[model samples]
Target: LNMANMDGDETFESTLLGEAEEVFVERIADDECILIRGTKNHSSASIVLRGPNEYFLDEMERSVHDSLCVVKRVMESKKVVPGGGAVEAALSIYLESFATSISSREQLAIAEFAKSLLIIPKTLATNAAKDATDLVAKLRAYHNSSQTKKEHTHLKWVGLDLHEGVVRDSVKAGVLEPAISKIKSLKFATEAAITILRIDDLIKLEPQKEDKKYGGCMDEE
Candidate 1:
């Protein structure tokens, strides 16, 4: 493979020595090059970036790093889900059904959690200058209907494709995301919400009168 040619894409250009001459690989002060001695199967590639200013370069680096992280996560899990909020909408429908089976106060919490999942599709619709309420309602209807038919399974992947201004199968539309990332995000969000609720309970258990103390002093002054 031509290593130099492989690096030259639309957004980047690279040059490499073509001769087979043996040259000493040495580390030098203030030099960007770092020698990597490894087998052919264990080779590494370097990226070079340039921009008009430091801010642009920083942003570019961040974006490239995030892309690589996504690739790594996808490789680790070897799994993906339909994007465009399709999974969230489907989960919302399933959770709502589960909430109906519960008889305790937990049912209300589960139902609210299910409702919160729709915010993803709602935000997508609103950002696209579409009617968020109508679009979310329609998306929810699609996923709910999927549970009734074996042949309409594709409806589970139905979500708003903002670019096309239509609801369609996101998986067929080539919109996918790393399944592990989604799982991690939902896990973190739930943990955070639980922590916040604990803090609120602690506050309620020992109500502070700090405001009243200062208010009384001000009135006397």
Candidate 2:
């Protein structure tokens, strides 16, 4: 299909590509569906997603969309980071160190905010039916704790392996994500959280003015 809006001399726009040919749709047993697309003048890519339930199918669709978005973002920035909460873990460690440099009451707030970043890994572990506490403890050591400080000092790519319920090298395990996504997500979350936490409002009702005497006089009258 032709991309509707594009500049004439744009380098990477697939705007005027020819229509697809030999397209076919097929239905298989066991609630499966497939579509095979054949483009005329370019390479065509296809994906097959099969899930037993509607929720699973929708989630898979969302994941595919997210990955495509990440790819587009990475192409624009040419920077990527290890996924599976590895990037978050690294940021959490950095924030903790940075927090120590602050010498005001804000240090405590900074430290607590840093701790909140670990929620990514914690939720990942919990969703995989693993113990979030154990995984987070291991991840803290894998990325930040002492004793391993000398050995793991420069290895900031370690992340929670949710499937295995362990803290391991996410980069080597094919877990990579767009760096910009994580940074943006963290910034937005932190701002939203701080804004919500600062809210202070109160309401009071005029304390049932003359409730008993007024009601008794009304009844008697």
Give the winner by TM-score.
1
Per-residue lDDT value at 77 in model 2:
76
Q: Which sections of candidate 2 miss by over 4 Å?
A: 1-40, 43-60, 145-151, 204-221
Most lDDT-accurate candidate = 1
Lowest lDDT 10-residue stretch of candidate 1:
12-21
For model 1, residues 44-118, the per-residue Cα lDDT tens digits are 555777788879989999999998998899999999998888989999999999999999999999999999998
Q: Write the per-residue lDDT of candidate 2 for residues 28-125, one digit (tens) a residue.
A: 54554555456665565766778888799899999999888878999987888888777777777888999999999999988998898888888898
Following a full C-alpha superposition, what root-mean-square deviation does model 1 have from the true structure?
10.9
Q: Clashes in model 2: which pairs?
A: none
Q: Which run of 10 residues does model 2 get worst, by summed lDDT?
A: 3-12
TM-score of each: 0.71, 0.66
